[model samples]
Target: MARLGAGGMGEVFLARTASGRPLALKTVHRDLSREPGFAERFAREIRTNDRVRSPWTVSVVDFSPPDTAPQWLATEYVAAPSLADWVHRHGPLPEPAVRCLARELSAALVSVRAAGVVHRDIKPGNVLLGAERPYLIDFGIARAVRDPRRTRTGTVMGTPGYLAPEQATGAVAAAPADVFSLAAVLVYAATGRSPFVARGEEPDLPALLYRIVHDEPLLDGVPDALLPLVGECLAKNPEQRPTAEEVRARLETAGEQEWHRVVPPALVAAAGSREAELRGLLAAAQPPVYAPVAAPPAPLTPPVPPATAPGTPRPAEDLVAAPSRTRKAVLAALAVALVAFVIVMIVPFGGGDGDGDGDGDGKDGTAPAGTPAPSPSGQSPAVTSLPAAWVGTWTGLGPGTPDADGVARARTQDFAVTVTLHAGAVGDVMGAQVSNLKEIGTGRNLGCTEALELRQMRGNTAVLAAVTSHPTDRSAAIDCPRGNLYLVTMTEPDRLTLESEGAQSAGAPAFLTRGR
Candidate 1:
């Protein structure tokens, strides 16, 4: 027996079947096997995993409870190392490879969602970098869509660095949460460090989670096209994040063809036996049917034995000839009609519309002259208006300190400024400052800069970056820490907030309405 690895749950061993077929057999830990509910959950996982069919997902072969011996489950043995191992050997993955990894893993999540299963753990350790393609392993934490108990315990089941905000909060998560985890994994693959690393000694999981839930990620080197999708996936609110299918669709639209590589020989050989075992299990689950044989012809009268010695012979007049040509033609026509009826019954309808016009309207389906054009949501006609005045720099308060009374006091400082819009075009110094000043000031310097670069403005929000000081120490000496930068954006019309560690807010609208 070849030992693969051991964990808290169980020990995985490389084993061979009676026919010399290789397989990976995982036996449940002694302690877990003794638990009353472990068996049921394990059985459910096996059953659910069996239903999942994806090239990137591992296949389950056999599962046996500890009725007479130790409980064990067998899965396809992928020979490649985990993503974590690969990263350890080679520094960080290249940008293209990182994007490729993200696309593939996100597509895998799509499959898992289709199978009615959520892979709660999507960290690097659970992802295998096979020779041909990546595979998602360890469905140990996989729960069916309807598993209430899985959420009730609120167990921190996934890796700390890769968990979504909702997962960290012990909230019930859907497929989007997996996407969030995948985004984090991609970030880690791009950069050697996790995106949410703390400055001090050890990173605080709760604080990191709070940041993930409330703030945008610090994506400095990530590609622009991929960053937006990653941001959507890592949205603080689960509802705001896109679905797995949406992620796959967008990635495909972005031209992600030829991403799947050939499977390595070792992995292919290992997966083959496991797949065969799964087929056997399915075959065994179904019962076989035998067609009835026609009864033997009835015996003729006994008196016929005198003439034929064994059977009586029918008269030549009793024999009937086959149908006539006209009759055969009519029968053929009836058969054809029956086939056409069956096809109509089985084939779906309304599949395609010419030129992809879903409503089946003509190419020029427009309103007549003098008629009002229909607006989205069928509301009042939209009015084109000028940009608002509050599109420039606006500041509020800053973080405060505790008073002598120890009642959690804060200072009423007016150091906060929110830039709604940048003035000029790209490469223009003034416009660059106004556009990216907040991001540079906040992310680069912890919000210590007097003036920063304005990266871009969206609606009422602006992303800014801090400018480098002539002498780093000189800026620090002047009480303006070089690294004290921030990224501030308007949450809505009412509130202007900073994305610094100490988020400051002012002019918060009492009833701020969301814009499209």
Candidate 2:
């Protein structure tokens, strides 16, 4: 196990299960865990976590019982860089990717609202740029919206500059506050500067709060396409801002193609390489030892199928018969082989039902698939639906349209999309698209890849969250606007139709055929 980092309440470690799948194990500080009412608070957070079921957020795998010493919580570890880290190293994201980020984050907020929760923090640091999609992480400060026990008067939570005006003013964050912060984040992604602060300037906390309440966001560098929405989000009146659902609806024009335009190739390569490296390490790591079980005594090794060789007795048969050095060697070999297989194939990193890799049943004391895994407080996991019959590649084309500027000088381009579905649960899809048209003036080609996750299914139609985009042809790919949802329907045995839900210019569903 590797120590990832530490936080105010606990220390986080990257540990592999007996099966070698990686997980983020967060152990609460012993002093904090023993404090009065801390157990109830921790348990409540676990219950709150179970209610938020979005493809954009990480899921809890298992946790220690609340009453136990050294209480801990385990969640699926996302092998991706945070939005804050990426922007700081690579600079601000292009307009298209920022738009995509907006849509994805809005969808996350939608799920949070559905669960009657409000994420008090929605800054870039909390967003992980996964290979397929962005994941919202670290929900430590989230609170129930309707719960009467809200923040104490005069107490404010959230980061400076990114906080909504009301949140900075000591008001309890609501769904709309999340929207406000979402816009602020978009501003930073587009300009590498906070909406309320000038470039290269870091004001004191109180001063930043005053500006949030009194000043208009500095949107000088934001794209024209996103200017209005970002301005509206920064509005002093929280009621004036769009709801998370509405924000998602408004960004429908920013489809998978737009996402491909803004992501840097270096970022994409790094994410993929990091994931491969982690898997390699897992395969090489030794199995973790376990303490002796009480009384009945657990099996010395994991179970394996009977051997198929003719006239060869199974390991179980040998165990029942006698104690021989040769038999013991054979049993030990089988045990070692079984452990490797589980690590290499059966168990996946971040054990959860949504990963679309395995059935999350807690066979070896791990949490069951799809539900909240048991927390330290003894909370059981919940059950959710998995994807069925939507696990294949589908391709289609959108008719050529004028460039984003809508100027007469802009060139028209047709967009082609290849949507690949995996057999996990929702939000387990990848898509790549290329433009038939060249750059407005230059003859260079354009293309990009995006991460999509299943949102819901209505009969033969699957609604997916367009999580994030990655650029394939960095120079030629142009930034596109944001849209959060896509509806795909199996029109025939070999045909599918995809439409961006709530897109104003969405004319007709694009017809797609099964791809090789």
Candidate 3:
């Protein structure tokens, strides 16, 4: 079996059926399979997916959920190049190709919606490119329409750049949410990048969310003929976006004559590339006897942004409502794709995993065949420079209004962190104490007064050196190991965000609200 892909929840591999037909198999890692109710959720996802019948979707073949230590699912093999890989290597799909993709994907949504399912995660990596019937894959996080059990625990789901506005807030996604994500996908197909994301960047969730909620999509280079339709689909209000049926109709009718475009040359070549790569791998390995295999943890799906430091009362998913630690366990499963997408781990066909990270083949500064194109602007943050956007205090909802027993808070608990730009040589610091902390971590929380040194920047993220502090009156010096090593832009000027590079608590890492 060749390793096909992996994410935070499980890994996928290519396996041959008893009849010698190739099947894509996914095995749930042991950790998630052990969580209570996981079996039920996985069971639900399969049940809904089985009902979706679209030429555009990979057909679900079979699954094993025997209440055992590990679980696996299989789908018909689709060995086409991924849209992410194609776009990463070649600039963007031609206009006619983009229109064709929209029409077929919209058709896929019809089948999904008819089955009462929502494909909550529909980014480019989940789409495959082929000469005939390019397929959509990875419905691992999909849910039945109005399925209340879906993510009720408040875990943030969906990719940052592709998520629908309501989905970004952790609300249950509906069919229209898929339309929103598909619009983002089309933008990437046309421009070789996310509508809201620049290349080589870790999306700032808060800003990306803001764009989904309030800003116009960045459809800069989209073909004029297709722009209006793509723009309408990207509207902030779900109700305002076109229905899947309408999207399909508009595309087919508008370009009735161009329907025979089949697949673009780049995409056809991409298919050839996958076959060659797979053959090379097969040649080096010995044929193995068939046997069941375990899969690695799927991509990293990060949890909801940590509560806005204390009192600011930022909106958060209703994760506090879940009655048990199962939410935490589920969070581990929800990494964006669900939350794994928050932290995003969707694996591209040739790219390592779906985070757009390369496989380290750039020793000579030449991007390998499947590597993402170099960023169009901005250098790595190694120079210790700060963007003007991150110069203020940001606020967010603090830990939920509870104590596991569902008790309420007194003053809403103020939780705010600030970034100050120092004059000359002092430089800027992800420094300063976030206000209002009755209790934070098991260790002594670092103060904002003791500045953590800014080290470098990676795309939209800023890296910082570990900070160590000694308490007054000759107290023990505390070293915050890997504490606050990076900062992500939540919202320019007012809200900046960071996920702990090392030290972290359950559902933390949110932003600046008020100016200090």
Candidate 4:
């Protein structure tokens, strides 16, 4: 069982099928089952509900009345928490998600109306959030357009915040009644508060109903694009409201802009940074280390300008340095010319002896006295390869459960490859497999260990074999897929290159490089 909730009519439990498919089962309250006419109404509602077939409508799978105990109805269980639960914890939803909810629920009502049914109740409690979608629930209160049960005297239905004016007045409702309820639900999702507020000692419910029928909603904070649509939904005359299909189209168009407008720039920057970091980490073949470099000395500050009354003579040191500068320039030029002459003299013998000697001496090519050797260009040493100790299996980030063996088994069955790593290896296994492997596990075989066999190791490339170990495993020769395995080779301490085949195959050679 995954979830449990209740409506005015019954309790709902969400469970999974044998194949792990989810389902929602609703059981009528024992007291309600015993009430006269409840069974007939429930059965009729179920029949009407079974006809709805919109993406937004909750699908009915099975339903049964009490033969010996409480009656129950089963539906396709959506795989997400409810909107009410989401609101309680996350406060109001973003404007886009709220608009999406409103549009989808309205479309669902249109489908129900096409089936000649009216969902007398449309509230947050009855909406289930599915991953990437929404599901409308609690159709047991639905009634056919001409159903006489809707005329029942002194019976008020629907939650206080969502009930339409006609619903409160006992007037037979059409599709617009649900539209009004949908608007209320949207208001709740958008603002975390209902449009109609209950005030004073004995809140005047009649005045609130009157306002809903005649007045415009106080639209603070509501998106301008959605305000007009919401106003149409809350129209006093049922004929004035647009059909659910129109609302769906309008909201879908509005949602794209709202989503873009609300996403924070910081989140976008963080995503970009993470992608860059991951790519760098995955491609690096060698471990990285940092060494501090010496800082350059600051330049000498220039002398400040001297204060002068009209036209004063400069200081003696500044005046004396003028001739000294010309003399120093002449001396520097002479030194450069001497250096050029020496280089020209040595050029006949290939600039210098191969053994670094500048003199013409034959004995070990020694340099002349008082000559200093030039320093080699300064550069950090390159990382050539990963540490030998790092060659072993490693785990990835996810829920830690079912043990390593269990995860391996599941992967072998679904993905057709046994996934393994060396003790400290960073990526998936390489090489040939003895048998096909699965990517996901079933109940009985929840193992996660992968056996990797080291095949060959070249300068920057290593070949490995991925072997599957299962009682029912079968072996076969398969073509290598491109980009399947990456050989990460470290050329220097800070440089790692990834080499792989450009295209992936079931079995293919992979390559890596230190640079483009």
Give candidate 2 regions above 4 Å deviation: 140-153, 254-261, 294-516
Between candidates 2 and 4, the one scoring higher on TM-score is 2
Model 2 scores a TM of 0.56
In terms of TM-score, the best-performing candidate is 2
Worst 10 residues of 4 by lDDT: 341-350
lDDT of 2 at 328: 48
Worst 10 residues of 1 by lDDT: 340-349
Order of all candidates by lDDT, from best down to worst? Answer: 2, 3, 1, 4
Residue-level lDDT of model 2, residues 1-516, one tens digit each, is 344544444455566643345776666556666677777676556645645667898766556653576666677777777776678778988777877888777788888887677777777667777777777765643331112212334755666778898888888777788889889888988898789899988786677788999988899889888899888888899889988888888877734553334577776777776677567556544443221111111211221223344554555445433433434454344333222111111111122111122212223222222222111211112113333445577777765444343331234466566777766554455443322444445555444455776665433445666576545566554544233456565655567766553222211225888787
- Tens digit of per-residue lDDT, candidate 1, span 1-516: 333444445445554332223456655545555666766666656655665668898766556632523566666665555666556556666666677777788788888887677777777667777656777876643341122222333655466667788877777666777888888888777765456663232455566666666667766666666888887887887888898888888877454544333333443454444345434433322111111112112220111112223353543222111212324453344323222111000000112100111111232212212222221111121112212432354544333221212111112222233333444432222321111112222232223323455444333333344554332223332223232234333344434445431112212122222222
RMSD of each: 30.0, 18.9, 26.0, 30.4
- Model 3 stretches with alpha carbons more than 4 Å out: 140-153, 198-202, 254-262, 272-352, 355-516
Query: Taking the tens digit of each residue's C-alpha lDDT, what string does model 3 give over 1-516?
Result: 444445655555565432234556665556667777777677666655665666777666666634654566667766566777666667788887787777778777777777666788898878877557657776754331122212343545666678888887778788888988988898988888778766676655456666667777788888887899888988888899999888877776643433235567655665565555445434432322111112111221112223454553533333222322433443233222121111123532223334332222233212112222222221222324554444444455445212422111112223334445332212344544333232233233322333556655433445554364333213334222223344343333344555443222222335545555
For model 2, where is the 10-residue window of minimal lDDT?
Answer: 340-349
Q: How much lDDT does each candidate structure score?
A: 0.48, 0.59, 0.54, 0.46
lDDT of 4 by residue, 342-407 (tens): 100001111121112211122221222222221121112332333352333221122222232331
- Candidate 4: TM-score? 0.45
lDDT of 4: 0.46
